[model samples]
Target chain A: MALTLMKGSEAIAEAAIRAGCRYFFGYPITPQTEIPEYMSERMPEIGGCFLQAESEVGAINMVYGAAGTGERVLTSSSSPGVSLKQEGISYIAGAKLPCVIMNVMRGGPGLGSIQAGQADYFQATKGGGHGDYHLVVFAPASVQEAIDIMSVAFDTADKYQCPVMIVADGMICQMMEPVELPEMKEYKVDLEKKPWAANGHGFSKKSGRSIINSMYINTEDLTVHNQNLQAIYREIEANEVRFEAYNMENAEIIVTAFGTVARIAKSAIDDLKEEGINVGLFRPITLWPFPYKELHDAAVAPGVKAVLDVELNAGQMLEDVKLAVNGDTKVDLLSRLGSQMPTPEEIKEKLLSMREVL
Target chain B: MKEVIVLIGNYGSGKTELALNFAFRAARQGKKVELLDLDMVNTYFRLTDRANLVKSHEIRLVSPNFVHSSVETLSLPAEVASAFALDWDTVIFDVGGDPAGATALGRYKEDFDALPEGSLTVLNVVNTRRPMAGTPAKLVRLMRDMGRPSRQAVSGFINNTNLARLARPEDLRYGYEVIREASIASGVPVLYTTGRPDLLETFLSEGHDPAFIGEPMAIETFMHRDWETFTKEGL
Candidate 1:
């Protein structure tokens, strides 16, 4: 179809539908409620299932069940509601279920205001739940980027048999933009390819029964399982570390940011360029893979005086920037809590002041 | 021009944008104007967010507890009921998106019904990209649905189809074709079609038929965007 203007949440939902995600289980939570609301209307018309469960916890568990059957599944919620899905996410991770969990993050630690915030950086990149596991997280900077990543998310989840998360904030979710969608991929059940799926075979003696469970009674067996999961994470880290580096040739300062904040920084950088300021930006598209090595190179690039980490939360991504820089250069942070947006003017002022770091 | 004009449409269909533009258009013509945010739903990105801009235009704006209320409550202020008693040259009702948002107007149905004939005009603003307004049949359905809640017949149609900065002349023509068919079927005239000045300049420069698209109305975007499209793709 030709380009059409749409709310980011609705576009992402249509992207999921195009990506062959036929099963959606979610609860209503502002900023992200449009995903499930659009699904509720379009799912049945397409012979798919869209179930609004009693709670966020219930919805995620439903994702686990649907995922076990090797069907592409998706669930979305805001920050507080996403917190309730942690336990279920852990179970899905342990059981190695392939599904997508989208969070249109809002300001929070507890019932915080409904506005965009990236405070969930640690919760998403680090293991938010118990045990040694990771959810491949994609942090899209724009609505079109979010729509483009949904297809990759499902394909990556199925490829590694792991759950994935697409984290966006209200700034991107509520904004309207034009998007050219991909062709719809038809959903066909071919359990033969996913032999590990819990789908029932013909009950023939030749087909072996598959047990979809994370509970390992024996400590030694669990240890081996954990090792295998670590190996998969390593492969993902090597392959999926995607980031965008802008104006890094002989830069004076490098700013590392993601999501909508990155674009604000870009607007600042664009204006600063007119005044002969030499600056660059490094935006991480995949949060879990983190782009550590690439960021470090950008940080240590010739003529770089310092690295500025900008975010909507109180330096949540600052920790990651420091880890990536590894003390190769000094890292300063520009942060605000509670979804208070820093305009291009504020960001430019901060950048000018940060130049004193030299 | 009617004294009281109600602008209704689906969410993101540019209803609030048109409301703000209309109120300013009348106020600039040396006419007293009152703009009412009669929407009870839609927490964020409401017309109340731009009260300062409206005040500068000399148009009195009424809404829920606002003037940058951080709480973003979803109830209309009591002053909305008193808007009818004001002696303004024009009163524009900026209804929330969808037919359900007009449910709040039921309390003022008697006041609306009692208005002198032709003093009120209810216009259905449409962006045909939205499924509810995608076709002629769907347009008729939405027009009736919006009319039911406000207890007013939709007297006209406004085509406001867009795709942000990417909107081109052809998209307007395509939407106008469908909206025109909708107008014919519903017995409502195509009052006008809206586009930004830049878009309109390019639309006429491209040699599109003006008669096919009706009167073109120029409007500016009013909502806040934390960031901008800093690249050629305007992502």
Candidate 2:
């Protein structure tokens, strides 16, 4: 396929279609609104379904209903809207259904500005909804990575029978860049093939009927279900940790960041390297199953002096980096709150100042 | 050469980016260029945000005074009038997207009309990928909407068919065909089909004349998307 320029939101929508996601339910919100807009136009043309739910809550519930039938479904919204969908998300998680949700984050506590921010790191990685379950969260730094992650997010969701979240900021949502789309995939749903799907096969002769529900009135039964969900999360943590290490072989400083901030950190690292300052970058692509071991290793690398965490918010992800680094080294933060993004020069200066103190 | 080129279109149709590309193109050819940032509808992705890059190319940037300030105002700055008074070889107005945005142009309708006939060209920049202007009828409606507010007739169309960096040759052809239909309906000519240099090559190989396609614009994706943050090297 030839390279084409695409906005982050539209690219993700198209990639989901190519990945065989035939059902989409979403409400409009800034930054991420393009996804729903794109799907609304493209889905009908592809013989698929696109519905603009009344609200975020309504949208997530629609996703839950669709996923119960073993269909590839998706929904997207920004921070505040994502919050509204939490109750439904919790229900979907409890039901052990599979679906993809995207939260193109914006600054917030309440009705935050429509600009990129990493403030939702805790909500996403720590599980926003009331739950004892975890979401496989993929934080992509580029549109291409967003496309690639979205393509597999559905498969991963179905594999674990859980919801997967793609965490991006408004910057990623609105920006346009060249991307080579993946080949279109053909996925046919065979109702009879999946005994667990609610495909209207009543409990009678050949196949057993499926009941999709999260309610377990009995305390003991609920405990068992929670335990099983924990086991799945543990397995995910052990196997799905993904992080990219740059110039880590011999570095005096290790910089930890993710998504858009990570790329800015990389440019800073490049400049620092030119100035003979040994700095490295560790970007965690999966936020939930954070690359704890990899980050710890990088933090304690030979001759490493300190660890710095950069973000678009005031030190939300910094806590995660601190937990990963333990007491192995000193941890610091460089951040710009709200919609502000730090430039490479700003990051480079911060790193240099940290080096002086070290 | 047109003394003034006015770019108007629906929101998110890549009008600001196209204006920047056109300004740089004229400056590279050693033409004295002045860029007017009349976009007040969108606070982000405006030409004023890239003042340093524009000045680096030796192009004078005229922007609304309220731009980049905490206060958002729709009033055109006095500098815009000063820009019109200048004797620059080429002056490009990066109008706000949409008809509401084009209302800013009404303030300068008199000055625009004073220019000799054919010296001013209003090009409706169309990105077929955008939902609002995807079809010829919708595009004709958009042109009409913008034209009514600017009080100037659209002389031609610029086919900016793209899916961002993922655009292919077929996308351009698809957009060109729609624009062709739109041109007939609106009685406007299709002045140029613009896109990234690489994708434009595919259009040419398919027998599109360079003159018809216009010079391929090397647009820098400065409006940072999430992908640009991590992938430093590639466009």
Candidate 3:
């Protein structure tokens, strides 16, 4: 219960430690390297294992190894590094491993820049790695949200026995902010209860079988497995649609955004609200099973004219907004691509321009 | 015409190591080689610091201004494009990890495509530990998902585990087999095997350096060889 000024990436790393994450693996990359660097410096003090792997690939595999042991494990990387991490992420999902993966996105089609951008939204929520599986993804807009959602990310991963991703971008990772640490609680990880984990040689001998965390199985078995996965996904959809609304009452417009962009939108909303434009914000905390119903309601809300979806990419989130809004509300996009982050003033200007079009 | 072979791979799979060694080998052969470091993905492992040594050997060192910058294409200011348009014997573009980081290649695909038969070569580093580091099945699936089919690309894989700890030349050898197997299974060629230049020197001097030899082998041929035979015979 202490307040500290920290970068979003540093806060996430500290929160992971407090949340009982004792194993960390990561490769250093810009904007998000602080997470790994911080873990490398401090993980040893808590008798934790921190391995800065040969590359993002090795780091992710190390995570896979730790997760297999039912230990609290985490990995962090930026856009390019995250791209390298996709393969491991997919395998973790197929195996239904419990772990935390963080992507501090930067601008780019190729090593875009060290600057912030939201280009990886589609990649993160849609499953960056290959497969029919989803990682419970949390999009944090501030340092505090980074800590809070990361705490929830661990719980959700354990609850679902799936990998959870904390998708932040360069801005959130690099910017320093005031974070009031949450009340400390002893971290309790119950990997022993899960019959699936590879705890040690003794567990395997006692069980009289080697546990395999693979999706590949006989045709009938594979089908059953997939169906079960579907059930889990449905449960998540029903139970995990989380979002925050600001100034929705009597608002004529809903500014739909997430992560760092959403925070910027909130400031712009305040400015526009004072100007009597009645603009509100819908920031989705869980972007994976995107708060579709929340989006639908915002679009159909009384006096809502249009939903202005702003982002750091060239309209990646626009399509989702359109789908969720379902043509009832006019969907407009304000975007920038490749390392360019749109500011609050620019976003407000776009919102006003969208009103004119409406 | 001067040819440029760009080495592309995920981080820590040894792009910098391969590119550096390849540049030296090509230079020794009297080929006017220019090794360009477009590796903007990693903050370290840049070859720009050694550019003077490379230049002293009469080998051209063409790169963007920010050699230390991660994300080659985006950080290597636009001026580097003119360098690409030039006539060089070998131009190696050490791309960053992931296809998104290869965005610079988006424009040059056509240019490289126009190269006289067997001009452009893309060497992909494969490490068994990373995300796509799984079996060949996973690599194919990932390539397909990323929309970069290996069928047409002159893609070959070199297995290299650049891990500082628990990494020996043996780890590199294991990497070679995994990557070779995946390349063969995916219908890409096992163009070469990579290791630290010192370890690979004997093969390099014997003209057996698989890294520089232009081969037209496809993924099918790569996969056709028996796993045991290839491992023993050096795939």
True contacts kept of each: 0.39, 0.36, 0.06
* TM-score rank order: 1, 2, 3
The regions of model 1 sitting more than 4 angstroms off are A201-207, B66-72, B144-148, B197-216, B220-235
- Top candidate (lDDT): 1
Best by TM-score: 1
lDDT over C-alpha atoms for residue B40 of model 2: 74
Candidate with the larger DockQ of 1 and 3: 1
* Deviation in Å, model 1, residue B173 alpha carbon: 1.0
Task: Report candidate 3's interface RMSD in Å.
Answer: 21.0
Model 1 per-residue lDDT tens digits across residues A240-345: 8888888887689998899988988888898888899978999999989899899998898889989999999989888889999999999998998888877778
Q: Mark the regions of model 3 whose C-alpha exceeds 4 Å error after superposition.
A: A183-192, A201-210, B1-235
Pairwise lDDT winner, candidates 2 and 3: 2
DockQ of 1: 0.41
- Give residue A304's lDDT in candidate 1 (0 to 100): 93
Cα lDDT tens digits, model 1, B1-235, are: 3499988888778888899999989998999999998766666678887888899998898986553444755666788866677688899998878677877776688888877888888878888876446789878887787778767777778888877667776767778889878877877887778888877666657665555456788888776432354332221
TM-score of chain A of 2: 0.97
